[model samples]
Target: MSGGSKLWGGRFQKPTHELVDQLNASLPFDRRLARHDILGSLAHVTMLARQGIVPLEDARAIAQGLRVILQEIQEERFVFRLADEDIHLSVERRLRELIGPAAGRLHTARSRNDQVALDFRLWMREAILEVGEGIVETSQALLDLANEHRDVVLPGYTHLQRAQPLLLAHHLHAYVAMLARDLARLQELYRRVNRSPLGSGALAGVPYPIDRAFVAELLAMDGILENSIDAVSARDFALEFLADLAIVMAHLSRLAEELVLWSSSEFGFIEFDDAFATGSSIMPQKKNPDVAELLRGKSGRVFGHLMGLLTVVKGLPLAYNKDLQEDKEGVFDALDTVALLLRVLPPMLRTLRIDRGRMHTAAEQGFTLATDVADALVRAGVPFRDAHEAVGRLVAYCIAEGKTFGELAADELVRFHPRLAEIVFPRTVWDAVRAREHPGGTGPEHVARALEASRSELERTARWLQQERQRIDEAFARLLSEEFP
Candidate 1:
């Protein structure tokens, strides 16, 4: 047995079994955090030098070595080994190669526990912003589609049955609204994820004269994680991220479901572009909406990750356990899945052809105007429940007579209730949709205003993304440059 691969093997007399090494190694997946690990180490060493815990020359050496490792990783030249266990060790091992023993002093005031926590938080901060940007782009795509088809009418459903007429824009806006909440969740969680977890050494505060606030500021984080124990052990930020991603996936899945249904011959409300659709291996006539189906199907994987992390953390005693190693793969995978979903869905929606005539015709065929007719009855001085019942009977009579609401004459309508004759029913799908003029309604004007509001909201979110990204970029650039306090 050999202990050469283990960084913390100083006290152990013999190395663990090879199977244990393979079981415990995280470098395979966690190499994704290599850049973040280097960034965190840079901040830590800079702070250590500034606080006089380590000499400025040694700090410069470590910083220079880390920058080299970062460049190698960025250029695809950095070698990662499973024996190094995880990103922290992989980078440290490489840092040793580049700068010798000065790399050893780099870990002076921090534990791998706090170090890993800080690295994950830093990575998640960038990820939340990236996911937010993806949300913005996706929202923009939906808005563009809405703006283009603001007047196109479709049947809105309740319990998978047509219930009312809605603008296509209004329908697309529903997803934009859902994604807005998803973006808001990421923004809110960003605050929690942005706090620094460095200086909380191994679940306890370090005794050295380290400046946690300086380190946090250097990394452009919001603040330190105040509680040392929580700083190292808390995986709540990851959990929140996964939960938010699951919601985003749910929204995408719903939209994907509609796309699937609409593209089907039974609905024929939309058609996917050839680029977005896949053909059956044996059935040449079939052009499948595989992207949409995938969007719907992959949601479960993200949901499972959220639940998996919840279960992983549910039984753990706080303050950093080996079990916490289970956190990154799920988070990394969920983020990738969500990012891919956001990336593909917008284009899938944008390129697809909508059958406006088909949607309007379908909208007209369903008794979507039943509610409007009921409301008209109430306006004509009928009591609400009586009006509902009267409309119910009218629908039944139409169904029995092989008639539609529009096919019934005034006398025929009056047979249900004399007052119904006094109220003119909405004559067309547009009339049914335009009847809803209130704020947030399906009316054209309301949807137009909603699109404008979404555009403005998108602009605000875009500005925020730019500012936040710039702040982090500048802070990181300064950390690498020759300028030092």
Candidate 2:
């Protein structure tokens, strides 16, 4: 064994093995956290100065040095090193080389354990805000689409078979409901992630008479992670985040699958914008829903990333371990996937052409009004089960005769049950759609009310996201400013 940097090697007899160095390095992916690492270092060093743990002059020098590195990274001028293993070491390595022995004091009372944890939380806080905004904007787009097509009625499906009639706004609003819950999950996760883990030091708490609250406040976090071992070892925040992302992506995939189905000639419920669709290489006639299809496919990776991270943390014991290094890559992948899909989808949806005529035609053909007819029978004193049975028999008879519900004459209805003849069935598709008058029903009046409610929810969600962003911005300003209060 031979020559390695003396930074962490005072006790070692040999240089780190070349293969091990390459294998252990996270620089390829985690170099993106350089600014976050420096931000964490700045907070830590500022705390050190505040508490007189390090000389004021040395703390000032370290602070300025870390700020300079942060600027370099932002400008894409910083040189990342594989030998440094990860961002924390790389920043400290560069700091030592930049500011001489003053840089040596930068690590005082801090370990890469808690330092990296703080940096990661900072990064994910911003990430959550960003992804939350994406979810909000996506919901807003759905609201806009629903608002645009308020009167369009489409077939609602069960087991991929048209089972009832629903307004297109109702369908779009269903996704908005799912996305609203997703946004709520992201908001909750942000609070969980916003707690600072910096003062936990390595595994045991640092013994420098340092104030964890001071550092946490400076970082604009909720509070400190009280247990040192849990502070550095816990990755449930990442798991929770991935879980949120996977669910959102699953929702997106469902919408995407519908888009794929709807854009086809067979369904023709929607048509993709030219920019949002693709053509086949072999068949010039083929206009494929590739973008929507791809988003649907992308859910696999988000799902895989969630499972990957869950597996990584499942058996790990308390306190930090190198196994924890397995965490960020999966998280990063899921975050990137979610962010990209959300960004592309809103615009694509805004430009899509809804085929109101096709949707209306499909809704009418499905015997969706059978429920309305059954309900009508119930109103006419047919027992509820008998009404359902009566409707089922009527539908089977119509299918056997190659006729629709609309084709059955009033006189023909008496054969199913006398109650069927007594009831006034809706004559046209619109008549059938309008007959289902109930709150949250696909009736035009109800869908309009739902649309307004979704609009209100979208506005509220947007405001909530803006407040979250403002809080982060204000915190960063405090962290970067000369005043520590």
Candidate 3:
């Protein structure tokens, strides 16, 4: 069977094949842009009327019709037709039905090329802020956890072997630092995504006296995309978003990996809340850290989306292509996945029980205080390299005799270096941690200051999100108002 495209069949003598319709239609996925499409159209139609390209009365009618459609979609009353091909046409077809011929004038100075580009950028502008909020929430959660466990010390590892002792607060602060960078990346990317491309038309600039700047203002965009061709063609904003999302997932996956390890029977440093853990069907005693495992596993999923978009975009020709349609779903999924992780992770972290005794014991078991002992020798006028070599031999001697440094007699210690007989070794984990009182160190006073600074940073990011959200909401509220001139 063959049929003409309901919205674009004027020149076709014969209709498209049914198979082509299924292959060509983007209504299923691109329909996610319905709200964004209406919002963009509202701005475009208002601009058209101001420039005298569309009659004022007709612009008012089109704006009314778009508001109705927006409400329909919001309330789940709108129908999506595959024959309409995409969100742009679906809204157009419905607008025509609602207000007759005036709806047609709404698109007078725009084409689906620039229209979709506008909708996508609008969508991303909102999404970037939303992701920023998530990052803030996650960072705040980590900071809260660090504050709650400020006195605990744990073995910090390199190459999976315990190498040094650190405050657990310092370890959690590392993730907070990574998330702050993720938030910064989104804030930077927002500037690029905030430009309007609506008046670019198909490829070359529209012939009408369209005011791109006014449309951008109406939509709360920062400015117009300067080049008409680039306006409809550029997708680097989305690529950058995906790239930032991949980094976010990488940070989250690291935290999740640590959670999984810490909750295990062998490590026993923490326990997941029952709500965040799962029980096995066959194993009677298996309480699995499934949520953490899933969080860790989903990082690759986001990474794959980033790679997929890059590959799709690498060889694209100038202007627009149907190939550009491949961009949305990956972005949608990646954002949704990151949002879900942020929502669940904070609660999971807040509920987990920390075994401070286990962490402190582990901190002491790994010869973690050796560096502090070597430093003590350096303070006694022994060269650092000599101090390190002497400490290394002392460790070997303790291992051979099946004794710890605390168990070594003064006679035994003096065999390595005469100064070792007089040096008071740091046998407790607190001794090692308290010795590092410099800024950004694992010392109690420094961790306390860092926690306060991190909390302040998180508060600033939250305020930024709230203000940006208000700006966008006010723009849409004005666009949806009944009084359109």
| Candidate of highest lDDT | 3
Task: Please give the range of 10 consecutive residues that has the lowest summed lDDT in model 2.
Answer: 1-10
lDDT per residue for candidate 3 within 153-259, as digits (tens), equals 99999998888899999999999989999999999999999999888888898888989999899899999999998999889999999999999999999999999
Q: List the residue pairs that clash in candidate 1.
A: none
- The local distance difference test score of each candidate is 0.88, 0.84, 0.90
Full-model lDDT, candidate 3: 0.90
Global lDDT of model 2: 0.84
lDDT by residue (tens digit), candidate 2, 239-348: 99899999998999999999999998899998899999989999999999999999999999999998998899899887887888888998998888889888998999
Tell me how far the alpha carbon of residue 338 in candidate 3 is from the true structure, in angstroms, after superposition: 0.7
Give the TM-scores of the predictions, in the order they appear. Answer: 0.97, 0.96, 0.97
Judging by TM-score, tell me the better candidate of 1 and 3.
Answer: 3
Which candidate's TM-score is highest?
Answer: 3
**What is the lDDT, from 0 to 100, of the residue 267 in candidate 1?**
97
lDDT of 1 by residue, 1-485 (tens): 01234457668777878998998888899898888888888888888888889999998888888888899999999888888888888898898998898889988998888888888988998999989999999999999999998879999998999989999999999999998899889899999899998988987789999888988998999998889998888898999999999999999899999999999999999999999999999999999999999999999999999999999999988767888889989999999999888888788778979899999998988688898889887887788899999989989998899998877888898898988767787878888888888998998998899999989999999999999999999998988786643
Query: What TM-score should be assigned to candidate 2?
Result: 0.96
